[model samples]
Target: MDRFLSNTVSRIDAKGRVSVPAHFRAVVQKRGYSELYALRCLDLPAMDVGGLDLLDRYEQRIAQEDPFLQTADDMSFFCHGDGTFLKLDQDGRITMTDFIREHTGISAEVAFVGRGNFFQIWE
Candidate 1:
């Protein structure tokens, strides 16, 4: 399928790298994305992880709002300011940096829960 489906639990190595599930990697590749964009969830102890399309969608929504309003700036701050790019290595792994760890509370392990076009990283 072209969408992220199912879930996977992966262990983090000493370098804080963890393999993105093969199925998820395939979906990402099929969508022509070279890296993943991860945004910390506003109300949850998790991260909303996806590709460029996801980030673009957020931008599109922000564009629909009036730029002079505080709401637009707030949305931009939450979606872009709190987001980070995750690059997949040769082994389809990504480093869980402080941006992710602090938001998800993920330490030795992480739970990758698929959410259709995107997925979430949880502790």
Candidate 2:
């Protein structure tokens, strides 16, 4: 399996599209991830993910062991949001929705951070 890794910063355009730093994209592609999953980060306010299934599975595991009432807050923040399925364009750019942009505090400056099996977008 391939690991996600980042070494550069990227810029997000007015259209909410951000260029995936070349090195990062290469690593993602090598991992067989043509598409990325994005959702707001609960702990880190300005961070979002690019691997939904992995996150979903993690959430499911927690939900199974924890009471719904106890985990409600986290569920609302992590699972109930509008998760986006982002496809990397030919130019190595992905379109972020306004909601996602706002959630991650993404302006013109963006950071692409790798997290083993996925990546995070930070402002």
Candidate 3:
């Protein structure tokens, strides 16, 4: 697994675009992914970032859990949705849309924290 490992702070441009850390970009590309998926975190005021494979692994785990298990509804409805997909530009940056920006309260800058299999972008 090409895990994202590191912590980096990036400046958000006026247009709401931020350059992904070089290490993170390299890991994603090495895993054969050209795009990234993200969502407003369910329990936290941050953005959850990952690739398709991470989402797949997540769904696979959820599939085995009992439907009535604790927090299952929250996971199935709130946290689990078709995440916003953004293509990496030539410079390895992704522009956050208004919806994402508003939900995350992200403004002039952000902290990108690696979480092994994924990462989180915080205001």
- Which candidate should be chosen as best, given lDDT against the real structure? 1
Candidate 2 lDDT, 21-100, residue by residue in tens:
77777777776776877776767855555555666665776667545565755565656555767788898888867776
Tens-digit lDDT track of model 3 for 41-122: 7787787888887677667777888888876665666446636887889988889777677888887888899989888888
**Model 1: colliding residue pairs:** none
lDDT of 3 at 110: 82
Q: Estimate each model's TM-score.
A: 0.96, 0.75, 0.83
Q: Quick one: ranking by TM-score, best first?
A: 1, 3, 2
Q: In candidate 2, which residue pairs clash?
A: none
Q: List lDDT for all candidates, in order.
A: 0.92, 0.71, 0.81
What is the Å distance of residue 40 in model 1 from its true position? Answer: 0.8
Tens-digit lDDT track for model 1 on 55-93?
A: 888999999999999999999998978799999999999
Residue-level error in angstroms, candidate 2, position 22 = 1.9
Looking at candidate 3, what is the lDDT of residue 53? 77
Model 2: residues >4 Å from true position, as ranges?
66-77
Candidate number of the best TM-score: 1
